[model samples]
Target chain A: MNLKAIWWKLFCVLLLIYVAIAGLLSPVPRLNILNETIRNLYFHVPMWFGQIIIFTVSLVYSILYLLDTNQKNASSIANSKRDIAAHSAVTIGMLYGTLGLLTGMIWGNFTWGTPWSSDPKLNCTAIGMLIYLAYFVLRSSFTDIDKRARFAAIYNVFCYVMFVVLIFVIPRMREFSIHPGNGGNPGFATYDLDSAMRLVFYPAVIGWSLLAVWIWTILVKYREIKLFWNMRMNNPLSAVALDQV
Target chain B: MQAIITLIKKEATIEWRNRSVLGSLLLYTVLTVFLIFFSFRNLDPLSWATLFWIVMIFSSVDAIAKSFMQESQERWFYYYTLFTPGQLILAKLAYNLVLMVLVSTFTLLLFSLFVGFPIHDIGFFALALLGGVVCLTVLFTFMSVIAAKAGKNTALVTILSLPIAIPLLAVIINFTKKTLVVQNAVIYSTDIVLLCSINLLMIIMGYILFQFTWKE
Candidate 1:
């Protein structure tokens, strides 16, 4: 790993430490129903932000894989880089999305009287997970390696369109979305998460997203090395791959 | 242009020749809606609206899943050179849209016959039906091509489609809920806009991605 990436990982760790301590202990606005649970704003929302950013990175890689399928003097690393980035980003992104959903459910149970409230945002995230799960199912169904990646990339792009609609359009269109934002009412921007909360919330989002990217980079590097090692394994007497490790 | 027209014509002729398939699908739709009515007995307007949509969603999925299945291997190879991927998908989409419109309208009729009409806004209700069914057909057709190309497994087809399709289902159900407000002919601008936007997004995605899919 590069020194720069290590520094980023260190920064993410430090920032998350600050978020965990401050997020729980900080003085939050004591609104009637929400009361203490407003602290979840710093933790839960960042998971979603991180998930979306990671998924976007995954989608970018998939697009690159598709566009570069027919191009020039592509090194072996560059060729497989697309699959590595897309696969790892999706793995980490789904992790964040699942964690976000669980935390949101817990927070909802405290504030909204029920964990499984029919909030449009909650439903969208749930469906988003299902869509990605289907993407995995699509991947496993294919026996050919290159073919699987091609189809997965295509599905990834198409499904993201639906994902965009779920989060952005549907919640805004509905009139009772329960998300404090956009259900015929002004969204999270105009209300909810007062300035006091934004202090932790913004940093929490950045830290979590940076952590996700760091994990993703590690995954990519590991895969790249594995590819290099496999190439070296063509000659059994070679210890060259071990030197890189 | 001619390619698209010819493909649509071919799709229609084949569908006509295979009348029993369409007949059986219609029979299945009738039975499904009827069984639902018998089980529920009588639903409130909202419940009825939701039930009607549930039936249409499943039936549309079943119907559109067949869009890419009818071609023989040799026919597919022959047509591969005859049409661009865009032209092929456009024709399939157009044909499926027509099929969904007819089937959905028939479904609405059967729903009224069996389940009783709960709709207050006939105008908005039809708009929702048209928009919703078109959305269903577009999505499942796009997914159908992908599923068809992947492995042609029926169960896998539903698994392939359910995630992306459910969000559209949720939006349509919510839109239908608006229509059941006990008011006369109420259609909100916002709901209409949202439904249209979802449909537009699906159509554009289908157009863009089908080329990659059909290349397989």
Candidate 2:
């Protein structure tokens, strides 16, 4: 990795370590129905925040892909690099979304009496996840790499628009949603989250998002490495090493 | 504007030429409604509304997929020279929207023939039906284009359309179900506006994005 990436990795690691120790050891407001599980706010909510930012990054890359005119030439600046950046952001963003959902389900089971509720918030997020899953399916059906990038980027833009509708717009319109502020009586039953929780909560969001960006860059680099592997696939010297790895 | 009209006329002539495809689609709709009718012989109002949406969803998928997939790539190559991607997509959207509206209306009639229409405000229900049809048409048309470009993979039609459809469907379903459960009640106009805005957003995106996919 380069100097900037090294700095990012250093910051991500340091921040996450701080979040874990300080977050776990921090004093939390004791309340019924979520006495100790309240700490999950630091863990579960950050995944969602990280997911939204990562997807927004993916959306930016997709727009860049669309704005590019050099898409015709494979080796050009608009070709594989931007395409891979868009793809990497999408895949890692999907991973973060899935993690967010799974964590929410566990937290719900503990606090809400069931792992799955018909809550609009949960349902909409599920829909959002499906939108991205469809993204991957759209990607797999293409055989030409360049066309794959173009079509998938178009679909990515469309998916992000719909995802915003489902995740953010729709939930706020209804009053019955279980999510805080929009539904269920404003911000976790009107008892404001304690100041200490906000301290870890804000940093966890930053730390987790940095980790996502770090992973996203790794995937971007791996795309180039994989391209190299594909180029060298027929070489006898590389065959044994590839097989062993 | 001229390009879109001529392309649409071309699409119409092609659609009319393929009578068997239309016949099979009607058959598929009838069979699906009949199956739902047999399974739930007497459905409650909510169930009836849900069933109607389900039947219409499948038929719209079939109808729109046929519009995109029926054209062989050789034909697409011809059209590529003849019209721009924006014109081609807009024409296809227009044709499929008209086709789905007809199909959904017929499905509603056939579906109610078996299950019965428990909807109180037929006017708003029809409005919701039209809005739902627009959503389905715009979405499946966009998705079918993506699927068609990916080498005419038909299975990708449903896989790609559902996630996008489900959220929009939730709004429509809730709106439709409200009419079913409470007679002559007004659903929040905000929802209707949101739905319309979704349709508007989709067409705008289609207009902007089809150019990139149009590249050879």
Worst 10-residue lDDT window, candidate 1 chain A:
A70-79
CAPRI band for model 2: medium
**Which is the leading candidate under TM-score?**
2
For model 1, residues A104-140, the per-residue Cα lDDT tens digits are: 8899888788989777677777788988989888888
Q: How many backbone clashes does candidate 2 have?
A: 1
Give the share of true interchain contacts found in each model.
Answer: 0.69, 0.73
Q: State the weakest 10-residue window (summed lDDT) of model 2 chain A.
A: A236-245
lDDT of 1: 0.80
lDDT of 2 by residue, A74-140 (tens): 4344456678888898889889988988889899999898889888777767777787888888888
DockQ values of all predictions: 0.55, 0.64
Residue A136 error, candidate 2, Å? 1.4
Q: In candidate 2, which residue pairs clash?
A: A181-A187
- Count of residue pairs whose backbone atoms collide, per candidate: 1, 1
